[model samples]
Target: MSFIELVGLHKSYGRHTVLQGIDLQVQRHQVVTLIGASGSGKSTLLRCLNALEPIDAGEIRLDGDVVSGPGVDVNRLRRRVGMVFQSFNLFPHMTVLDNIALGPIRLLGAEPRTARDRARSLLERVNLAHRADYYPDQLSGGQQQRVAIVRTLAMDPDAVLLDEITSALDPELVAEVLNIVRELAADGMTMMLATHEMHFAREVSDLVVFLEQGQLLEQGPPEQVFGDPVEPRTREFLRQIVEAGRL
Candidate 1:
């Protein structure tokens, strides 16, 4: 069975449908990248996976446990899913260490010392150990995002959802954040990333999913999806992004 599965997922905000009948399966330790134009629902899909945005229809299952569906306990299900956003949503008043430790302490009931140690290790993993005592306002954008990632990792989630995590960083700083993610991928972290970085997506992802107008247009290994797209829409989308140097 797939490690993560979304079956016929649909979501809407009032009358506006943001996602429609989306189906995807991500295997263990695989890195899947979601790409699409703005307002294409990529972020919304990731939000649904983490239960930040509830689905209007269909189901999502993680490790065979239903996370989205009738009667599902959303809070309990969220413990297994972690998300990092485009904007680093760290608490302004909290130090980097406290931000990372908060989730493990509150959600997993780890002792304060234990959570602190775990947070420290995660900060080290992201190569931000020196900034552990700094508040979010004092850190660079890349550093803050890295800390956000560590904060999510403290929960030891089954899958990490990255929604354009580097989009807010400066061009030079984007590489640093991507490097951390690359290291995690090398260690076989299970991740789903919604991104505009087509080069990184092509090189690092095991699978690439292309969405347009809230529909899954194509999905396959990177070579097939990006190298020789079978769908005209996919080809056109790739061309536009490539010509604009946004891919």
Candidate 2:
């Protein structure tokens, strides 16, 4: 079975449907990118994968275990399936090191020293170890976002869901953050990301899935999806991205 599976997924907010019978599969150690225009349900799909938002219909299975629906242990689920948001959701009161260590210490019951050590190691890998003592407010947006990704990594999740993690960064800062993602992909992390960075997506993703109006329009290898998409809608989206100089 795939490491992650979304089958006939459906979700809604009030009367507006955000996902429509979506189906997807992600293998272990693969990097999958979700691309499309704004409000295309990319973010919502990531949220549903991590169970931050419950599905109104269908199932999300992780390694053959159902992760969706009521009675599931979401707290435990999050430990295995971590997520990073665009806003860099670090604790304001915590230092960079503390922010990253908190999840492992609190959720995984690691010794505080052990958690902090792991956090520092991850920070060093991302070239942020020097900023360990700084608060999120004291760091640049890229640094803060890097801390957010490190925090997720500290938990040692089986898979990660990144929700447009560079959207809130300055243009100069975006590359610094994406570099970390590139490294993660190289290290064989199982990741699913929602991104508008078309070039980066094409370069790093094993598979690219496109969504439009809450529907998954097309999905395939990056070359097929980006080089010669079969869907007309996919072609138009790429055309717009190319015109914007984003692809």
Candidate 3:
């Protein structure tokens, strides 16, 4: 069975429909990149996957379990999914160690010492062991974002949703976060990323999904989507992004 599945998913904010009939399947160990212009529903799609935003219609399943159906246990479903955002939402007053440890301690009922240990290991994974005692304001934007990634991973989730995690960083800093993601991909982490970095998406993702106006336009292997796009809309979108130096 696929690791993550979304069938006919629909979402809206009163009158504004953000996603319509979205269907996707992410196999275990696969990296799928969702790319589109702003307001195209990429981020909304990611948010709905984790139940951060409720869907108006359709179903989301993870590990063969229905997570979005009526009466589902949302908390139980969320434990297996983790999300990282563009803002690097770390607590300003907390040290990096505590920032990473908070979720495990609160949500998973981990002991303080055990959570601290797991936080340290995750920090090491992101190569931020030396910054564990530093506060968010003390580190560069890149470092803080790495901390955010580790913070999410400390939960040991089965799937990670990256919502343009590098979008808020300096141009030079973007590489640092993308490198960590590349490493995770190499290690077979199952991930779904909403990204503007076309080059990295082509290099790191197993599949590329193009969304336009809250609908799926095209999806396929990275080569087919990025190298030889079949749809006119995909080609036009790629051309614009490439010319803007965002690809």
TM-scores of all candidate predictions against the true structure: 0.97, 0.99, 0.97
Best by TM-score: 2
Candidate 3: list runs displaced more than 4 Å.
none
Residues 1-247 of candidate 3 have per-residue lDDT tens digits of 9999999999989999999999999999999999988999999999999888989889999988889967988887777889999999999989999998998899999999999998998888888999999999999999999999998889888889999998899999999999999998999999999998889999999999999999999999999998899999999999998889877
User: Which 10 residues in a row give candidate 3 its minimum summed lDDT?
Assistant: 69-78
Task: Give the candidate order by descending lDDT.
Answer: 2, 3, 1
Report the error of model 3 at residue 22, Å.
0.4
Write candidate 2's Cα lDDT for 59-91 as tens digits: 999999999998999998998999999998889
lDDT of candidate 1 over 1-247, digit per residue (tens): 9999999999999999999999999999999999988899999999999888889899999888777767878767667778899999899999999998988888889999999998888888887888889999999998998898888888888778999999899998999999989988998989999999999999899999999888998999999999999889999999999899876
lDDT of 1 at 196: 93
Candidate 3's error at 3, in angstroms?
A: 1.1
What C-alpha lDDT values do all the predictions have? 0.90, 0.94, 0.93
Q: In model 3, what lDDT does residue 42 have?
A: 97
Model 1: weakest 10-residue lDDT segment is 69-78
lDDT of 3 at 221: 98
